[model samples]
Structure formats: C-alpha cells, structure tokens
Target: MSATEQPVHDHSTAALDHGRRGSLGQIVSWCLWDFGSNAYNTVILSFVFSVYVTTAAAPDEQTGQQVFANMQTVAGIIVALLAPVIGVWADRVRRRRLMLSVSTLLVVASVSMCWFVLPYETHHGLKYLYLGAGLIALANMMQQVAEIFYNSMLVDISTPSNVGRISGAAWGLGYLGGVITLAATLALFVLDGGFLGVPEQDAMNYRAIAVFCAGWLLVMSVPVMIWGPPAPPAKGDARTLNVVSAYAQVFRHLRRKFRTSPQVLGFLVASAVYRDGLSAVFAFAGVIAATSYGMDTTEIIIFGLAANFAAALGAWVFGLVDDRVGPRFVILASLATMVVFGGLILAISATAMFWIGGLGISSLVGPVQSASRTLLTRVIEPGEENEMFGLYNTVGRAASWIAPGLIGIFTALLGTRLGLLGIVLTLLGGLILFWFVRIEGVTHNRSRVTSAA
Candidate 1:
C-alpha cells in the first residue's frame, strides 16, 4: 500500500458519537435544503435550460454544442476557485446559513431570469442565449458555494454513527424532489402543450419551466433557514484575510492533515474523480434522452422522473447496507455497478435499452455520493468539519473539467457513444484509486443502526 493509503487510527469517531441524535424533524429540516436546491440539477443543468441553450439559444446545432461546453468549463473553473474561499469564510463564521441564504437567493434569481429564451428561429434567440449563459453560469457557481456550507452542516446535525443514513436520506429526498419537479413540469407544460394558454412566442413551453424552477427552489429553501441549527464560530480572524491567503490557509490546513492522516488526502483525490463522472451523468441525462434515445420533451421528462425515483430508492436502501458492511464496500459496489450499466446503455442504440440502462446507471448515483460524505464525516477532526468539506469541494472541482471536456472532445472526434465512454473511464479510474484508500476512523465497537433505511 502507498504511505497515504494506510489507515489512520480512528480516534475522532468516538467524540462524534456523543452529539445528540436530535429530533427527526430537525434532521429533515437540514435535509430540506438539499431537496430544495435540486432545482438546479433537474431544471437547469440536466433538463430544461441546458436543452434550451443548445437547441434554441446558440446560432446553430454545432455552435450550440461548442458554446454549451465552453460555458460549463468556464463555470466549473470559477466555482472551483471560489469554493475554498467560501468554505474558509463559512468555517470562520458562526452561522453557515448566512452564506447559504445568499447563494440560494442568487440561484433563485438566475433561474427566474431564464423565462425569456425565444426559439432559435426568432431574431432575438441568439441574444437570449448569451443572456441565459451568463445568468445560468452565475447561478451554477453560486450553487456550488451553497453546497459547501450545506454539506459542512452535516457535522452540526448528527452523530457519527448515523451519519451515513442521514446523508443518504438527504440525497434520496433530493432525488425525490427531482422526480416530483420533473413530473410536475411534464404535467403542467410539456404534456399539456403549455399551461394557462400562454402564447408560444419564443419557446414559451421551455421559458415557463424556468419560472417554475425558480419558484420550486424558493419554496423549498426557506425551511432550512427557519429550522436548522446554529453553527458555532470557526475560531479564525477573518477581518484581515484576502483571496490569495485564503487559499494558502487551505494548503496549510491540508498539509497538517497530510502529516497527521495522509488517507484524508488520498480519499479526497479518489472521490473527486468519480464525483466528476456522477456530475456528467446528471447534467447530460436529458440531452442524451432527447438526442440519442429519440425521446420527445414529454418522453424525456417521464424518463427523468423514473430515473430519479430509482436513485432515491437506491440511496435509501444502500444507506442501510452502508452502516453494516462499511462505506468502503458500498462505494466499491456502487462504482462497479455504474460502470457496467453505463457501458450497457452505450452499446445498445435502442431507446428501450437506454431506458433500462439509464435508470440502472442512476440508481448507483446517490449511494456513492452519500457514502463519500459519510466517510469524510467519519474522518475529520472536531470543529474542522466545515473546512474539510470545503477542501472536499475544492479538490472535487479541481478535476471538474475532466468529464465535460472528455465528453465534448470524444463526442466531436468519435461519437456521442464515446462521450459515454468518458464517463465510464472516470468511474473506472476513481474506483481504481479508491481501492488503495481506506475508510478513515470507522469504529466497530459502536452499534450499527438496524432500522436505518
């Protein structure tokens, strides 16, 4: 084993065991942020706005694809750069809710503005495309910052023993929210041929969905602010800080982690690769359903609902197993399942094959993600969870370009099927790297929750 791969003795897990379980209402309130924030995933990135941009906003099909790629790459870089700073700032503050509220409102405002993209045939479509790109891109960056605080809050809500279950519950509920929103979108607009008799001006159906997404996010985000716990101050002097030194602090903190427990760094790197692949899976699902699977807008939305439902079920079910078998085993199995099903979908050109394999592929998504959070919660020291989760986002975003770049390049040079190959390779590569990294500070003496799912 590599030096970094050796397991650190699990000293911190016990201290985490002492925190109150808190009421189930409180836990659900914390998870409600994830449920609400998923409007970005379902509506903008994966389903509505992305498709609108590439299909209607750009000058033509080819240009639209290129523009979409460039937008994502640029947005990913901005989010990556800002994520650590936000994490550090969040760590310094007494309440993560302050940052969370600002970021959430930005997302809400951005999606609301997307109600204007006209059809590509219109004279104003190109102008709207540029406008949509800027607004959506800004929202995307803010969403990443919001999640850094959202995830860091996990430390405040639960004890170590049930962290996996809580993580999975939040992830599952988020996907459930995705299924509900996608279904509602389909019912209200796409299936009914536009609700409220709104005249079709510039892709009015797609435009209306943007307004709906903003409303959905706004309603769901309020509960977390009202009900979640207050975080203690991070014990740092933030008044004197600037951007460059903020990153330097991150580096120094990571250095300390490396000296004390190299596996933390090792796991961070391993998880980053797979999370990129997972992001691609969500971001491109609707595009693939429409383009490659021969699905109409309504068909695509139905597929989205089914896929997200499967993901929610998988996440909740896997959480039960995670507490028993250990998160290491769960992640290994989840990644392997994704690779198999992702390949299966690419090999078969039929829509039926795509439907079966697409849902299969999605089912694994939540478990790996939820378990990654759980493992990190198991590892990080007391009072530093926010910073560690921030490092998690920073490292994850560092390689964020990998999946999208590979998808863009391979789809151009080879075919769309080859783009699927890029996602597969990311999962495979992460699984390989993760093989060497052990789950930190997993304690066996603690009782495993038998009733978690």
Candidate 2:
C-alpha cells in the first residue's frame, strides 16, 4: 500500500459480528460538538449579545455596528492568514484531539467573560464588549481549526457510500441542538422570568445564556474525544515552530499543493465566494429583521428556531440527494433559489412582508448548503481531507469580510432595504460562478476503487 492509502480490512464482517458498528453513533457525538459550539454563535454572538452590544452596549448603533464589523474583519484576516499553516500542522501531527481540547477551553473562557459585562450604565460596559468580542473572535478561530480536524474524522468513521448520510446527520443534529438551546434560553429569560427568582434584565439573561452555552459545549465534546480513534502521525519532519516560521512553511506548502492540482485551487476559490454569502445570510439576518422590520429579540429568537428547524430538515433530505445525484448539482440548485427569493427579500419593506419573503426563501437555503459541504467531501483525497478542509476554512474566513463589509457599506449608502439588494447580488454572482465547477467525473475513479473494495 502507498503511504497515503488507509489499510483496508474486512471490518464489515467484524462490524456484523458485533452488531454492525455503524458510524451513526460517532457521527451523532461529533455533531453534538457543533450543536454545543453553535449555541454561542446563535444565542450569544449573532442574536442576543450582538443586539446588546449594538443597541445598549455601544455608544450608539452606528458605533456598535462599526465595532462589530471591525472585530469580525480583523478576525477574518487572522484566520485567513493562519488557517492553512495550522492545517498543515494538524496534518503533520495528526493531533486533532489535542487541538480540539485546547480550542474548546479557549471558547469556554471567552464565553464566560460575558458574565463580566456590566450594565449599560457603566463605562466599563464598552470595554467589556470589546474585550469579549476579541476573545470571541479568538475562540471562534480555534473552533474553526478544530472543526477542520473534526470534519476530517468523517473519513475514518464512514465509507464513501455513507459519507453524505453521516455528514447530513451531523449537521441536522447540530441544528437541532441550536433549536433546543435557543428555545431553552428564550423560555428561561424572555418568556418567563429567570430561573428561581433571578431578575429578567436583558444583560443578565444574556450572561446566563453564555454560561449555559459554554457548559453545554464543554460537556458534549467529551464523548467524541473518548471514542473516536486518532489518526497516525504523518511520516515526515514533525517539529513545531513559532508562528512566523509556521506561517512561512504553510505558504511554501500551499504553493506546492496548489501546483500539484489546480482543481483544488479552483474549488477553494468557488467555495469561498458562495460560502461567504451563505454565512452572511445567517450573520446579518437578525439585524436586518430587527432594524428594518421592527422585530423584537423574542421574534428574532423565534425566527432563528424556525430557521434551524428548517435547516435540520434540509440537511437530512439533501443527504440522500448528495449520495444519489451529486454535491455540485445540489449547490447550484440552492444558489439559484437563493438568488430568486433573496431578490424578493430585497424588494420588500414591511415586517409582514419581510417575514413572508424571508421565510419563503429561507426554506431552500439549508438543504443546498449542506449538500455543498458533502460535495467538497466527495472531491478531496482521504488523507488530505483535514488540510483541504483547513483550506476550506481559510477561504471561508477570507471571504467572510466581503458580505459583512458590503452590508455595512450598502446600509450606510443606500439604506437597509437596498443593502439587502447588494446581498442578493452577491448570492447571484456566487451561483453563477459555482455552476461552472466540474464535479461529475473528477473523483469517479477513486470512488469506484473504494466501492469495489
């Protein structure tokens, strides 16, 4: 066997003897990490705390928006520059568990900082907001890195035939986790008073939500660390280096890797454009609804729950399509839907119209996006999956600045309504570019060999 080839064993017989040890259980545990982690993104970062920082926490809404955008932009820059390097390190060390553990701790610590956010009256509130944002950005970087490794583990657990199912199941479970967390948070603070006589101040409730999310993340990650086996270390020089040297080596490696296959580079470029647009849909959706359509925090939370539920359903349904059809077709279809319905959202102004148009378009977003991910999985070589996903993360982070920057720019120039028009245009452009990606025959031989085995 070549150095890159994983040992082929008739584990199918062993699995049958031991009641068919399916990847489903491990996949579920892996997904639970996303579920727990995204609680921060949905409840704290995107929805509740973002509103708090912008509306109440900042000097004003304009300043809040600038600060928020700036923080994200800076983080994206750092992640874009560092991701490929760290991805190479991950591949060399095969130490995904260690990386995951370190990153999770950082997330927990950063989230716990929410407890220190004073009420809006104090000057320290703004300082706390900036500090928290910085930490959150750092934590998010770590989370992204860990996800590169975690996603790579999918190859270890499932066959090519079941990869889509496994990926879809993980994504669905994560969304379900988000739905539950959001619901619990809303019930605890918004709908009812805080647990056991706690006050119902927005800041206080948000703090509790952060703490809950942190605890949830730490706890849920335990199972995967315990049960999922580690990959063997790469058989090359594995010495660690300072960040500067690390980055230099990564750049050198990236040049070499890209030269080896231009298709990989093309995939990254196309994925970056569309993925950024997709992320923007989640990041700014609440803000658009709240500022433009007068939706309250509670309403935003409800919408988020609805969106997550739809996303979960989409992932499951699309998983089958991914296996039977192809990931590229799924992505093209989703992007087209986004362009059409997204335009309707840009045209509408009233809150009722917003909800009607938004939800109508949102229904198609989840399934197509999930299938796009499965498509990436289909293209990469197994041993290189982690590094490629790391590149995926890098491209995503690099492109992250575009949509948010566009949103900020357009909102300032044209108004929130027209800002959405810019977003729709971005999605349409991404769809057009994504369609040109040739995926039908790229990995057919490798897939055939695996299936035949």
lDDT computed for candidate 2? 0.69
Cα lDDT tens digits, model 2, 319-386, are 77766655666677777877877777766565676676676555556666566566566556544656
The candidate 2 region of ten consecutive residues with least summed lDDT is 11-20
Each model's lDDT comes to 0.78, 0.69
lDDT score at residue 298, model 2, on the 0-100 scale: 82
Worst 10 residues of 1 by lDDT: 444-453
Candidate 1 achieves a global lDDT of 0.78
Relative to the unseen true structure, what is the Cα RMSD of model 2?
5.4
